[model samples]
Each structure stands twice: as structure tokens, then as C-alpha cells.
Target chain A: MKLLESRGLLTLALAGAFLWSLTGVDWGSPLIHTGGGAAARTFFLALFPPDLSPDFLGVALAATWPTLAYAVAGMTVAVLIGIPLGILASGTVVSSPALRLPAALVSRFSLGGLRAIHELVWAVLFVAAFGLSPLAAVLALGLPYGGILGRIYAELLHDVPPEPLRALRTAGASPMRQFLYGRVPLALPDMISYTFYRFECAIRSAAIMSFVGIQGLGYQIQLSLHDLLFRQVWTLLLFMLLLVVLVDQWSSLVRRKLAA
Target chain B: MKVAAVTAPAATQLAAEGIAKSYPGVQALAPISFTVSPGERVALAGPSGSGKTTLLYLLAGLLQPDSGRLCIEGQDLTAMRPGKELARLVGMVHQQFDLVGSLPVVHNVLAGRLGQWSLASSAMSLIWPRERRLAQEALERLGIADKLNQRTSKLSGGEQQRVAIARLMVQSPRIILADEPVSSLDPALAEEMMRLLVELVEDSGKTLIASLHSPYLIKKYCSRVIGLRRGQVQFDLPAAELTEAVLDRLYDLKAERI
Candidate 1:
């Protein structure tokens, strides 16, 4: 009875809050602008017949490589940054009660600070500081991705079954040793799987950087969209979809092999 | 019975004085005092909520007691920093076996020596496991050398227990604690696991404190049996004197005997 009451209360509160939030926009005003409906409909129609021209295919193929390269390179840097920071933030590596909380908090705050900024904002900032360069795009993607990965890695490390770690503790493995033998090994599968999932997100984010003059799939997407060549846009979107599908298949394969 | 360990007995094995622990509202353990000597095979027997595991945790320094002192060889465990000395002094086997299921059997066994290894050697060993012989020998002794490279979780319950015992043997701490170590296995496998563990402990002459469900196994292996009820000691008797009458009271079994 108590459980149902609390659950019902929570549901009501959420519904009320959602309804309240809807008031922020004026419902009387038409949400779509003049001709917007036609544009949206045309965009949807183009999906059925994407451009198959040989030259556009070549452009998409070229764009695909750089997008893939940026994602891999950016994720490489993110993982490098994430693993070390994640270890520190996990509080598993720090045994001293005095330091563990503060250390975790600082690392968590740093991760939060990094992750708080959107990837697009980071790309703009990096471009402003370093000029329009591939390195800038990589850094922009890597920093936020690293923060997200580090926070998740820390959570994974913490989520490891305490019994194994406790057994290690009683066995007298030092803090660092306990983490290496106990926590890290247990969390590895989940951490790897999550990293791959995050890498998929990074692929899309890398493509998005094209708007900031970082040439990739998104740059081509922008140009195609601007020229109102919706068919060309569909072709680019198809290529992006193919990339995501490939990554999805590859990651699942890796997961299966590990599980096996 | 084993006379001495490879690592010689410290002057005292472990002594707890008025040690107690409780969660937020419930007192898990009342203040309790006891001492365990080197080479002693002790069994902790109790009903479901008897605080046997809690006592073992306090002894292992895995959990801090709300009050009182715990010492191993006169070194206060509560204050002791974890390092080589602590690593060499104590080891534990959990009900779950506490093996990292994803890791291979060999790595789990070699993890016993992570404290002894230099940071460099330990790191390198992760990639190029140096002490294969030690791990192999422990597994061979436990009759599971074939399982050395196998992922730990893939092994059956009985086999995983062997891996855990093999890891403990490699650890070779002077004091060993087991919390229902064989509870997860079948009757036959449990007996076999118990026998192997006893043989190893006997050979090394290390202190063994196991919390057990089976009175038969407890009487068969332990020299001293401590019975607990409601977070307090009911009896701390020699195994011979741990008669059926006491067992009935310990477990609150009204009319059953085994």
C-alpha cells in the first residue's frame, strides 16, 4: 500500500511538472513557419530515392574515411585520458579514507566540468584557440568524450561486486594491487563494451564538427542541404547510417567474442 | 595434523578484545573477546543470524569494529596499514569463492603474489605472467592444472572453489579465514573441497577459521569449535566436546539430529 502510494505520488508529480513545462511555449502561435511543412515533407520524400550518381558516391566515400579516422583518433585520446582519471576517481585505488572522498570529488567535478560543455561548443572554442585544424576537432571531441568515459569507468569500477574486492582486501593486497587484481579485471568487460558504445556516439559527434569548418561527412551534409539537393543529402545520410551500422555490428561482434 | 607453517608462527596469531560491530539500527555483534593461536584449526558454528561472518570479517580487518581491539602478532589490525606484512599475515575465502570470474584461473592464483611482486614485475606479469610455475603448482596440487588458462566464471561451482583454494594456497598467509567456503557446492563436492582445504592448511600449519553450516565437516576438520547465537558466543569448546546436544541448541533444532 505504501509502495503504491509513493509510486503514484511520483507519477503524478512527473505528469504535473511535464504539463507545467509545456506552458513555456505559446501554443496559439503556429510552431512551424510558412513553407516549413513542405520543406519537411520534401526532406522525408527524398529518403526513398537517395542520389546514386557516381560523382556524389565518390564525395561520400571520401567524406566517410575522414569521419571514421577522426572518431577512432578522438576516441583513442579519450580512452587514454579516461582510464587514468577513471582510476583516480573510482576511489577504489585510493585506500586512505582521508584522501579518497576529496580525490573522488575533484576528479568527478573535473569530469562534470568537461562533460557539461556540449561537443559543438568545445569544437568552437578549440577552433578559436588553435584555428580551423583537424587537431582542434580531435581535441574538442576527445576532452568531452574522455570526461564522459572517465565518469562511466569510475562508476563501473565502483559497481564491481564488493565480495571479490573484500576477499582481496582480507588477502592483504594493497590498494593499487587490489584495484588491478580485483576491481579492474571484474569491470573490464563492461568498461570495454560501454567504451565501444560511446565510440559510436563519438562517430556522430565527429561528423557534427563539419559545421565548424572541420571537413567531414557533416560538412558535405551541410553543403548538400544548403544547395537544396535533398537527394544528395539522402546519399550522405545513407553513408552515415552505413557507418553507424558497421560500428554497431563490429561492437556486437567484439561483445560476443568476449562473452564466448 | 600439521606442526608448523612455511612461514613460522608469529608469537601470537590473533586476539580480539571486546570487538563489536553493528549496522545503522541493529547490533550485528555484541562486544566479544577471543584468541586464536598459530596452527589451530577453528570452526565457527552458528544459526543464520549468529554473527559468524561478521566475527570473521572483524578478525580479517575487512570491517572495523565499533569498539574493542583486534591484533595479529601484537600488531593492532585496526591501525595496521595494508602492505606486505598484512598480505603475509592473513587471507580469506568467501562463501561466493570471491574469484574474478572473467579472469583466467592462472591470473587469479598469481594475484595472490601481487603484494610480493615489484610494481614493475606485477604490471609486466599482467601481460607476460612470470610466475606460471607457482600458479601451475598450486593448481596441480588442487588437481586443476587443466583449468589454469580457462576463464574462471566458465568453471562450475565445484571447480571455481578449487581455483579459489588454489589462490589461497599461493597466498600462503599465516592466518586463513573461510566464511561457509563450501556452502555453494553440492554435498559430494563440498566434502571434497573441505578435504582439499584441510590438507593444504595442515601441510602449511596455518591458522584456519571457517564458519560452517555442516556440523559433520566442522567436527571432522576443526580442533576448536565456537558456537554463536544472537551476536554472542554460545560455546567455545574443543571439537570433541561439541556434542549433539550443543549442536541442537546452537541451531535451535528442536528435534533433529545429524
Candidate 2:
């Protein structure tokens, strides 16, 4: 009976997904175009022997700074906004029942609203509103990233061991005091690790945001691709990969130190 | 040692009147009343699920009684907010050694005084630990002074337990509530920990209320015993009067069924 019940549920879920996919998609179209595949293969082959001209290299290096700066600035804003919102959403700091529910609901709703819009969509909206400034890209990255970080932060706070928290409460520590001394210290390592992961995501998002006229590696890649300069595109791609690798190395070092 | 009559009208160090606690489906602690004088060592002894932990939590002001009153140092607990004053008066040693494992031993010990410090001071201490000497002294008393800079997770179970005691020593509360503090230790370690705890409380003239599983340890260290069964106090007697027959009766499943 249980097997049949689970199978029925699985069937329903698959049918629902199939129905959903039917909207706005042309099912009659060929799944792959042979000509497009050849072009993609050509692009892949051009990845080797990338453009290393001094002028283009200088441009790539300059673009690298903007990408890193946007990510850092956006993440700085995200951390500032996320930590407080996460604490509010976690509902651990408040003791009074009257305040806890509303605080949790409001903060959670705001987080959901922010992250519901993808960073690219947010960038388009900000560009419309703010007229293509660096602020538009930064805000676009900050809002959605803050929402994701806040949600994860709330979960980390909630997932901490209750024994130490209970012992702090028993020692007559106030709710804020308990949170600062007992809860935050215990959750700090996990929070730092998650933030680093988010920072890597933010870098990728910043690169993508350049498509909306922001100045970064993505903009350079788009311009090169438009002129059919595959070599330049490959060079820009290499720069992006190098940036990600450096950040990944740094993150692992920090996490290893935390563990030790 | 003076054994003040349990009914003495004079204000005691700790008092509970009809204190009780209940969960959705279980009565974890039934309404019971007791008093402890200054400088007394009391042991709460019971089988599993006999409300020993519940009672200790209530006394520590961690759990509010569904229906009763508690007074610590003659101040009503229910009327006042649990904060620095209450923290300064009551400390608890948990069975699980609830120190932050990633933090250094000195930081964990210094956390004992967090309630007493201003928010600014507490925040500053995270970067530049204030009162390092006090924390060092507490660790010295526990014979783990050299481990002060070591991360708490690196310590053994016994050393971690001693770090917990060092934290309590830094707290310097007049009343200490220990919830099965030695439950995780071996027999020899448990005995030594209990003896140290009793001696510390006695030397400082503090009130000690500890929930203990070992009848032998209770007889050896505690001045009084409160035997609980099924959320109620079955017997409250001087240690000398808590004989083996009393324990047998206290733990008898056959008698409980009847």
C-alpha cells in the first residue's frame, strides 16, 4: 500500500512538471540545431592560445578590479543587511510571544520578496530606475544576495545546539546576551563558511550583471563576441576563471584555519 | 554544622512554594515545596524521568513553573526579569559541559561575566578580552591554567568539565545548580569532580543543589537528599537518614505500580 501511494505521488509530481513546461515553450521545435553545435564547437576550440596582447591584457586587468570591487561592495552591504534581518527572522532573540511571531513573519516575507527576483532581473529593474550607474549593479547584486545570505543565516542560528543556549539562559543571561555570547560564537564558523560561498556567487553575479551595460569582464566578453573576436572572448573568459580560482583558494584557506 | 529546621520562618537562601512544570503531554515536575539555607549542600536523587532535571531548571530560573513561586536570596524570581543580578546570584554547571568548543578556554570562562558587563564592554572583550587575569585565576584554581589559551574542543572530557567549573568559578554566584554534572564521567573521575564541586561550594559558603544519580556520592558529599519519583518528592531527609532501604523503596517499580 505504501509503495503504491508513493508511486502515485511521484506520478502526480512528474505530470505537474510536464504540464508546467508546456507553457511558453515550443515543443514542436528540434531539440538541437546541427549548425549551432558546430559554431559552439568552434568557440570551444578557440579557448586555447588566448589573446595575450599588452593592450587587451591591461583592459582585462582593469575590468578585473571593477568586478572584484562590485562583489566586495555588494557583499559588504549584504552582510550588513543580512545579519540583523537573519537574527530577526530566526526569532531566537525575542522572548515575548507577542513580538516574536510578527517580527519573524515580516523579516521572512522581506527576504522572500528580495530573493524571489533573480539578480539579472533585479539588475534590469535597477538599470531602469537608476539610469545605468555602478550603483544599479551593486544594488542589484546586494538585494538578492542579502536575501539568500539572511535565509541561510537564520537557519544556521536555529540549527545551533540548544544545550549551551539553555545553560546561558539558566545563568540569567538576557536574550541579547545569550545570543551574543552563546549562540553567535557557536554559529560563527558555519556562518563564515557560508558567507564565503555566497561571496563566490556574488562575483559570478557581478560578471553577469555587466550584460546590462555595467563595466566588467562580462561586458568585455559580450563586446568581443559581438565582433566575432573569439580569441578576445576566450581571454576574457580566462580572466573570469582565474578570479574564481583565486577566491576559491582564499575561501578554503580561511575555512581550514577555522576548523583548526 | 547547623541544620536549620525546614519550617524555619527566617528567610532562607533558596525557597520554592508549590513550584510545578508541565509539558503538553507529561507533567515533568509536580507541585512541591522546599527550602535551602546558606552553606548547605543538597542532592536531588531519582531514577530517569523522575523530574530531577526539571526541578533543577526551575530553581535556576531557566524554566518558569506553571503554578508556583520561587525566591532566591529572598528576592521573588517571577517578579523580576532574569538578568545580571540574577546571574550574579545563580550559576549552573551542565552535564554536557556546554562550553563553546571552537573558543579558547579563557574566552569560555570569561563568558561567565557577560551578563554583568555593559554591551559595549562585552563587544570589546571579543576583540580584546577584558579581565584576562580573573579568567586565568579561575583556570588556575581548576589546575588547568596552562590550557587557558587552548581551544576547548582540544581538551579531554574531564578537562572540558573542569573548564566548565572554571567558568562557574569566574561567575562566583552564591548559589550553584548542577544538573547531573558528572553523568558523562567514569566512576573515578565522577567522584573526583563531585568532591571538588562540594569542596568549592563549602569553602565559599555557597548553597549547592545538585541532581545526582549515584546514591553513594550523595551520601558521601551532600548534607541532605531529596528523593523524587514520578514528578513528586518521595522523601526529603538528612543524608545520614537516607539508608539503603529508603533508596530501595524510592526505586521499587513494584511499589510504584501498586
Candidate 3:
């Protein structure tokens, strides 16, 4: 009887839901049409021959800066917010038993609340509240990303070997002292690597923020697609792809240096 | 190395009366009374579950006893808040050699003084080490000066243990507590480490209390032995009186069987 309600059954239920969703697709209504499908085909075919015109190439190049700037600025804000919240949520620096529990609970709850709203939703909300400004995009990216970074940082601090921390405590070191000498150095490599990974995600998020009227590669792509310039869309997309690749290489280099 | 003569002190270095600790369901340590004087090497000898570590932790002020009074240099540990004063007075060498793996040997050794430094200084030391010469001197004393800049994780277990000892050396505490500090080492390395610890204590005229698993090591280095069984003191006697018969009884083995 228990076997019928096991993990296998749960998996089967998920598969059933997915299969059911497939039934809602309209298979007969020109799924591949004369307008959209041909445009998509042209977009795919133009991958090899992206717009090489110097003026258009310059526009794509120019758009890349703001995308990079937004990502860097947003991540900086994220890190600034994340580290302190992470320290609090980790409960590593709170030694008094009376305060540690409440501190941990409040910080953890705040992080969860911040991350629960998707970045796009946050952007939309911010757009409504503050109009279409770069500040809105930056805050939208920063809030969710900070929450994620904070949660990861907390877990990393908590997961460090207890022995070293205990040794520091036994030596009459303060909670902050224990964190600085024992926890931070031990958890640093993991924190650095995770932060870089989030930076990559920040880039993608910054591009998507364009839908709310922030100018970036996504805005360029959106405009080109509306104008039926599939080649230009492909060109802007290549720029975004190039940016991602560059960030990946940079992250790898930084991680390698840290490891060394 | 010559054993340092026990000098009569104005006050005991460590005095514990009726010190007891209990976990959720188990009494880890029973009410036991003991006083350790200056310049004495005392070994706590016991089996695995005999509460040696619990006693050490209580003495180190890492865990507060449920009942009893503990004093260091006439200062009440329980009444006073935990701070650098207690750390300045006592040093502990852990069984696991609790050095941070990602840090260099110099940084791990310098951590001994973290309690003494201001918060700003401690943070600043991470970027620019404030006491490099002092750290190097301690490591040099431990004979690992060559490995000063190497990451602690890359060192061998025995080397790491030396690093732990070097950290304690830098601490320069008046009373030293070692919790099975050499239990992880081979017999030869254990003896060398034990000898070095004894020599350091002797030279500084500090109180040394170490929980040792091996009876032979205790008999060789320690002037006195406190035997514990089931969280209570079974015997407290000079090392010369700890005979094979007493050890067998301390271990609770039948005479005929032994």
C-alpha cells in the first residue's frame, strides 16, 4: 500500500500533468505559419551571416555597454546587501543565545521574501512604482539576486567545519572574531565562485529588463523583431551571446586565480 | 629535557569544585573537585567514554558546568563574561588541529592573538598581516618555519598538529590545556610532540594539563595523573604510584584476566 504512494507515484503524477498540458496545443492551426515561422527560419539562417554593416555593428556594440553596466551595477548592489544579510542569516556572528534565534529567523525570512518574487515581476512592480528608469531595473535585479546570494552565503558559512569555529570560541574569541578568522576564510572560495555565477545570471536578467523599456540588447532585439528585421535580431542576439561568453571566461580566470 | 620544579603559588592556576555538566539525557561529567597549581604537568587518563574531553572543555570555559565553581588565577570563570582576559590566561590545543585550510600557516598561527586585537585590526590583518614576525617566530620554534607561506590544507596531519601547537605558542597563555592533542599522530610523532609541549611548558613555568589516551605517554611526561571512569575521578595520584595493577583496575579489567 505504501509503495503506491511512493516517489515513483509522485514522478508518475508529474509526468501525467505534463502530458495533459500537451493536449492544449492547437496542432491544426498553422503552428508553423507563413509569417512567424518564416521569420524564425530567417533568424536561424542568418546566424552565419549576422549584419556586418559598420553602422549596425556599432549600434550592437554600443548596446552591449549598458547591458554590461547594468549587470555590474546591479551585482555590486546585490553583493553589498547580500554579505551583511548572509552574515546575519548564517547566525555565525551572533553568540548570545537570546538573540541568535530571532536574528537568524528574521534574516532568513527576509531573504526568502525577497527571492520569492521573480526578477521580471519585481521589474514590473518597480516600473509601475518608479516609471521606466535604470534605477528600477537595477533594483529589480539587485533585490532578487541579493536574496539568492545571501541565502547561498548563509549556507556556505553554516556548512564550514565546526571544529575550527569551536576552537576560536574556546579561545574566548568574539563571534565576529570567529567569523573573520575561522568561517570567512574557509568559505571564501565557494562564495567567490557562486557570486561570479550570479553575475552571469545578472547579465541575462538585465537584458530581459529591456521589455519594461530599459535600453539594452533585449530592447534592440524587441525593436528589430517588431520591424521584421530578423537579421538584426540575430545580430543583437549574437552580441548578447558574446557578452555571456566573455563573462564566463572572466569568471573562470578569477576562479582559477582564487584557487591558486 | 629536565622537568621543571613545582613552585608554590600564591593562588592556584585552575581550581574546580563540584564541577558537573549534563547533556540532554546523559550526565557527561559528574561533580568532581580538583586544583592544578603552577608549573605542574597533569595528565587526564581515561578510556574513550570516560569524560576526559568534557572535563577539558569545562576547564577551558568552552562549556559551562551545570553546577560548581571554576576559577583561573582567582578569577571566577562562570561569573565573568567570556572575553580575551580568559584567553590571555589559558591556551588550548585541540585534538583535530583546527586550523583553517584555505589560509597560510602564518595566518593560522597569528589567529592565536585575534582575541587580543581590536576588531578593526583583526580585519586589517587579513589583507596585511600585522604580526608576521611573531607568527614566523612561533612557527620557527615549532620547526615548521619553511612551511610558513604554504596553505594549511597542503600540510600533513603531523605538520598541522605542529601548526596548532605553534598557534598555542604564540598565544603565550599561563595555563595550557591539550585535548588528546596527539591522538591522531603515530607513536614516534606523538612522543616528539608531547616532549615539545612539555619542554615549552617547563621553559615558561606554565601549568600543563593534557588528556592522554596512552598510559605510557602520561607516565613518561606527566608528573601527576588523574584517572577518570564513568565521569568520576577513579584515582588522583603521582605518576610514580600509577602502577600496572592500578591501570588495570582503572580500566575495570579483572585481575586474573589481565
Candidate 4:
């Protein structure tokens, strides 16, 4: 009898919660959300109606340089900072209990904090600090990518064979020597593959940063959307998609070759 | 004993006095004393959990004994930095084979020289074609010269063991510590591996202390054998003196009287 009563009360609570959700829900908002297949449908209905607005395309082409530059620059700095810091963060490379624990803690928290904030949020902060320039995009991209790359690098460094390290140590190889010889070579392929993957992500991130007055393909997409020229927006979207696809293919091919 | 007359045992490659280790629930090794002389082929024969592994770890400087001293070449191992300096004198092969499976056979053999190489050069793989030649030589010595370019995973169990042996050959440490070096092989391959190990150690003028389960093989290859039971050295004697009575006692299995 008590079990039956409990089931009745549980059902009542769920019904109440469902009714409450009904009160605040705006279910229709999703129907018109930007790029929610509505604009996509409008875009395709125009069917090869090319938005070859030379003026707009010129602006996009001009912004393309900054987009490519920021992504490349950001990735280079991210990799440079990430690799060494990642090695330091990985206890396998340190092998000292006194320093390893604290270094690991710092690395985890710092990287976690960097990752918690989105690149858009970072761009806003950098724009405010540096006053709306290409530098803002670079800084915005660097932290998040560095955090990602560092975490991956640390994991790879830790996972490599300890046998080689032991062998090196026995041969009187220094800790640095052991890591360089034993750990780095094993981790190189994975790192390169992941970095290329990140480069793809950085391309998108660079475009997003342009909304804060920095210029890229994203800036063009945002402008086209604002003007309600859905056709032009599709072109920018196509370009971004093409870039992502190319980077994805390149990463896989490179990884395969490196593995070979 | 006058100062001029006092001469320590220079022939002794390793000496352990009162080495002990304990985990949370169990004592791994307890107050064990042992020694290995240069060119001596010794076997540590025991069942699982007999402290054979712990003893091997202590001798190889892979694990620190909670209490005791380990001396190699009259230099105190426990006194130096934990894995850093202790590794120089000891070459160890773990039971799992602990190989870099993706690496080529020659690269794995060349891994023995990682300790000898510098950080910059090691990263660059700048040890040159000569290093590869040396690795090839080591592989040749172990009769796997053709497998130099093949991935280590492509090799069979016995072949992998030979690759490991080749790595040890390149390491050229004063003492070689092998844990269950032939436990996974067939009887013939096991015998062959043991024979090769013995020959290599003898040729290099180094001491070998191998942990194993097979008493027959121990008797055949090793000059001396140490029997362990429940973290204690149950017996330490010449291989010829390891009688059936001792085996029965160590294994705790009674003989069937016909």
C-alpha cells in the first residue's frame, strides 16, 4: 500500500514539473533561429543565383589575409608554448615528487581555466584590452588552443614507454636526454596530427573573432546575415566549410604518412 | 689486518644486506641478504609472491627497499639518487617485456644507448647511420639481423625476447637483472634463450641474476640458485646442491611415494 502511495506521489511531482516547463517554454523560437534550415532553405531556393557582388567579395578577400594570419600566428605561439609547458606538466618528464605534484596541479587548473572560457569571450576581453585589433584574435585563439594542445601533449608524454627512459637513465642519460630520446619521438606523430586538427578549429575561431570589429570570413558572414542577403551568407559558409574540409583531409593524410 | 693487507672482494659485482620492502597489505621482501660475483650466472627461483620480483627490483634499482643497503661495484646504490644514478650500473628486463611496440626492432635495440646520448642529439635522431650499424650488429649477435627494420610488434614472443636481449647487449651494464626472461616461451625456445643469455653475459664479463620458475632450466644454466618462499630466502646454494628435498620444501608439495 505504501509503495503504491509513493508511486502516486512521484507521478504527481513529475506532472507538476511538466506543467511548470509548459509555463516558461517558448517552443516556437527555434523555428526561426538563424541558419536553422530556414535561411538554408531560402539559400538553396535561389539555386546557383551567385552573390558575385564583387564589392562584398573584395571585402571578404581582404579579410581573408587577417583570418589566415591570426590562425597561423596563434597556432605557432600555442604550439611553442604548449609543447614545453606540456612536457613540464607531465610528471613523466619531471620524475621529481617534490616538484611534480605542484607543477601538475598548476598545469591542470591553469589549462582548465583557459578551456572553460570560450574563444569569443577571450576575444571580447582582448579587444577591450588591446582596443580592437588583430592581436585580440591572436590572444583569444592562443590560450584555448594552448590549453588543448598542452593537455594532449602531457597525456602523450606520460603514455610513452618508460622502458626507453629506464634504458637511457641506466646508460647515464640525463632526464632531459631521456625525454628527448625516449618520449619526444614517440609523441611526435600524435602531436602533429592533433595540431593540424587544432589548426582547423583555429580557422573557425579566427572568423568568430572578427565579429568584435576584427576582420575575417566570420565578419563577412555576420555582415551578410545583417543585410539579410542569405545567398552571400551561404557563400561565406561554403568557404569556411571548404577550409575545414581541406584541413581535415590534410591532417588525416599527414598522420597516415607519419605513422608509415 | 694491516691497511696494506686489507683488500675487499673486487670480484663481487653486487651485494645486498638486509633488504626489505612492504606494500599496504603485505610484505614483498623481508630482510634478505645476497651477492652476485662477476661472470656468475645465478637464478632466483620461486613461485609467485615469494619476493623474487621485489628482490629483482631492489637489485636493479627500479624499486627502493624500505630498509637495507644495495651495493654494486662497491658503490652504494641506496646512497645515490633513486632511479637517476642507480640506473647506470644495472640493466633490467621487466616481466611484461616493456617494449615500445610501434618502434622498429633496430630502434628498440638502439634504445639501449639513449642514456649515453645527449638530449639535443637524442631528439634529433642524430646518432647517425653508425648507430644504426651498431644496432644491426647487436641484432646480428642475437641472430635477428634481418628483423632490424621490422616493427617490434611483428616479431613473435621468442623473437621479441631476443630483441630485448639485443637491447641488453647494447646497454652493456655491469649487472643484468632479468625477471622471468623465458616464462612465455616453449621448452626449446626457453632453453635457447637461456643459452644465449648465459653466453652473452659470459662474453661481456658481466653478472646475471635471472628470476625464473623452472627448476630444471635453472639447474641446467645457472651456476647458483636462490630459492625464495614468502618473502624469505629459503635456500641459497650451488645449483648442483639444489636437491629434490629442497624443491619439495620450497614448493610445499609432497612427493608421491610409490
TM-score of chain B of each: 0.91, 0.93, 0.93, 0.90
Give each model a TM-score.
0.90, 0.89, 0.87, 0.82
Q: What value does DockQ give for candidate 3? A: 0.55
The parts of candidate 2 lying over 4 Å away from their true place are A1-29, A53-55, A94-98, B1-11, B253-258
List pairs with backbone clashes in candidate 1. Answer: none
Per-residue lDDT for A132-176 in model 4, tens only? 877888989998888888888989988986765665555455677
Q: Return the candidate ranking by TM-score, descending.
A: 1, 2, 3, 4
lDDT of 3 by residue, A1-260 (tens): 68867978999999999999999998878777769877677779877787879999999988888888989999998998899999999988887899999999999999999899999999999999999888888899999999999999999998999899888766666888889988999899999989999998999999999888988888988898899787888888888889889988998898887666
Candidate 3 segments exceeding 4 Å error: A1-43, A95-102, A227-229, B1-11, B252-258
**DockQ values for all predictions?**
0.61, 0.56, 0.55, 0.37
Worst 10 residues of 4 chain B by lDDT: B1-10
The interface RMSD values of the models, given in order, are 1.4, 1.4, 1.3, 3.5
lDDT of 4: 0.78
Minimum summed lDDT over a 10-residue window in model 1 chain A is located at: A166-175
Q: What value of lDDT does candidate 3 attain over all alpha carbons?
A: 0.87
What candidate 1 keeps of the native contacts, as a fraction, is 0.61
Q: What is candidate 2's TM-score against the reference?
A: 0.89
lDDT of 1 by residue, B140-256 (tens): 987889998988889988888888888888889888888888877789988987788788889988889999868789888889999888899889999877788898888888756
Q: Per-residue error at A126 for model 1, in Å?
A: 2.3
Better of 2 and 4 by TM-score: 2
State the lDDT of candidate 4 residue by residue for B44-110, as single tens digits: 9877899988888777766788998888877788786543355557787756566666667877777
Better of 3 and 4 by DockQ: 3
Q: Best by TM-score, which number?
A: 1
Which of the two, 2 or 3, has more TM-score? 2
